[model samples]
Target: MKKEQKESLVFGSNLNFLRTRKKLSQTQLAVDLEIKRTSLIGYEKGVQPPFKVLLQLADYFGISIDALMRYNLSKLGEFELSRIDQGFDVDITGSKLRLLVTTTDKKGKENIELVKQKAQAGYAAGYNDPGFIESLPKFQLPFLSRNKTYRCFQIDGDSMPPVANGSWVTASFVEDWTKLKSGTPYVVVTKDDGVVFKLVYNKIEEEQSLLLVSTNRLYEPYLVSVNSIAEVWKFETFNGFEV
Candidate 1:
């Protein structure tokens, strides 16, 4: 057999196995690919189609051509799978921590692979170290626990200027409310406004409301109901501050 024919036969067997595992019939696979049933039968029978058709089949099956040919089913579990705009999820369960670097784009317009690559590079460069991560404390709230290695976000707004406008701020999950003191800086997530890193204060005469203060003079402190706040991070340190 020719090289192309041999490669196609290998892919065809793997494709047939995957289809069978998925419990899809040849006719069903043809419908999903928007191809005639006879074409899928020909592919399964070791017949190669044009490059364009092969590419379409690969895309529909969500597998690379090499994977289809080599047929290593074990690697399927390690596949970097994600839905568009859903972001990537890393499970570091046994390690007691997980690093999740979500895209900075709120509109979810960034490419997922590019975002993952950037995040991975940042982590590889020791972005979590004290100097690089501690400088963020002045502008936003830091986490309560100093022991945990937290992931910092690169802030984009001038509203929290001078300290965190263009800096990376580390955030940790807050576990104890009693550890929080009045006038402490924290990253607060509310039910309505999403996340805000600001200093929190207990307002007198209003047990249900607390003060949210911004270090930037242009922004004034505001009151938010305690019930509205979902999460809080007591400020930590950071080193890299461009603004």
Candidate 2:
């Protein structure tokens, strides 16, 4: 989609969801807004409404323009898990949602989820699925940061050396992709590449893609679009000992 076209896509779904919630038909809403019925329909289809008209709609709906900007229609109760704006759901933090299972320890701290080496494939396929995440084994790691969510990944190949094969990596869930530093390592979950541990660079400004580089220079870096991304975890700490 053109740069202008991308931002408008979320508008249609949000408008449709909120309108249905209020039990207002398009024609009735149009009458309320004092606009032509077709004009309202165009807005629902993601056509950019006039600036003044857009503000009027926001005021009429009791929402802010910023709220409308991030409004994903995925909150419309559970049907079947599809995708979230071609990504994952943005949760209460105004950041991407992570499937975290928690239990209080003696110190009342929550345990982090661990994805073992053998279970890597399952994590790749089921990372987005609530049921799948619920079934994974979780344990408490004392050294982790208290307020953040994290996961343990079991690596397979030598693609990322100095970190070797059959070792577990502890990565914190990254909610905001924009804050990611260049040359940082991430365990990025994607639809195309399953689960990968790669060095990532931000290229989201130039193109809607991220540059994934391998630690081992033998492997070539490639571009993966933001749409194909499901989840991104920033490397925090790792245990090189094979368990």
Candidate 3:
């Protein structure tokens, strides 16, 4: 059978199952769908429905047709699934559950995977170990593991509050630090300034410098040269501490 046909069969089976489970007769379902009873029968008999109608039916059922079809049969752990607008995308997939970032854009998928792998490695490297790097004091490095094994941190200081301090945040290492985008929060380290948490503003002209911005006005932004950065932890959404 063609791929589309197979998908349709799966969707049809799921729809039939849900309808039967709800104890809705064909006439009742057809009424709910605003379609003739014969049309509902045809759908259960593996006839393809129009795309718009299919979407409408799926929405009424509160599920993606993709979910109904059971695509991506891999049994991912709970942590690996992130629900996007239309579907649930797997961020991490392994025997042991890891971190995942859901993305539908083809180009974004590559970047998201790269970030996930780096996070996994960093997390395994003593970054999440409590007080493991405390001796380094001024140089606080974040965990790099992609696996969901570390706790989240929340920033409280006005200097980094909006994205860092007040919000729950997670840190993971990035191999390609040059891929860092300005206006995104990062865990940045500098030889002269030590460790700082703020959004990166890399537009300064003097000394190839970048500005670290805080969400709160009480804190002053500071400039750090690009060359001074030791390592950059790409910021992930803060999952801890309710706002």
Question: In model 3, where is the ten-residue run with the lowest total lDDT?
Answer: 90-99
Name the lDDT value of residue 125 in candidate 1. Answer: 42
Across 103-178, the per-residue lDDT of candidate 2 in tens digits comes to 4547776667778777777777787676767677778777777878788888879989888887888988887776
lDDT of 2 at 152: 82
**Candidate 3 accuracy as TM-score:** 0.34
Which candidate's lDDT is highest?
2
Quantify all predictions' global Cα lDDT against the true fold.
0.53, 0.72, 0.53
Tens-digit lDDT track for model 1 on 1-243?
A: 666776777767766866876679999988988889998888888888667877876676666555455433322322222220133321111121223332223543321111121243333343324443332223222334435434455554555645555565665645444345677767665656655667778542223355788878688888865444544555665445443
Q: What is the C-alpha RMSD of each candidate to the true structure, in Å?
A: 19.6, 7.3, 18.7
Ranking according to TM-score, highest score first: 2, 1, 3
Q: Across residues 1-243, which tens digit of lDDT does each residue of candidate 3 receive?
A: 787787777667766866865679989989988989898888877788888878877776665666556432222222222232235432211211223322223432211222122233343353334343332212112344444222233444447654543555566654444355789887664555545568887542212356788767787788765444555566765543452
Best by TM-score: 2
Q: Per model, state how many residue pairs clash.
A: 16, 0, 15
Score residue 222 of candidate 2 by CA lDDT: 95
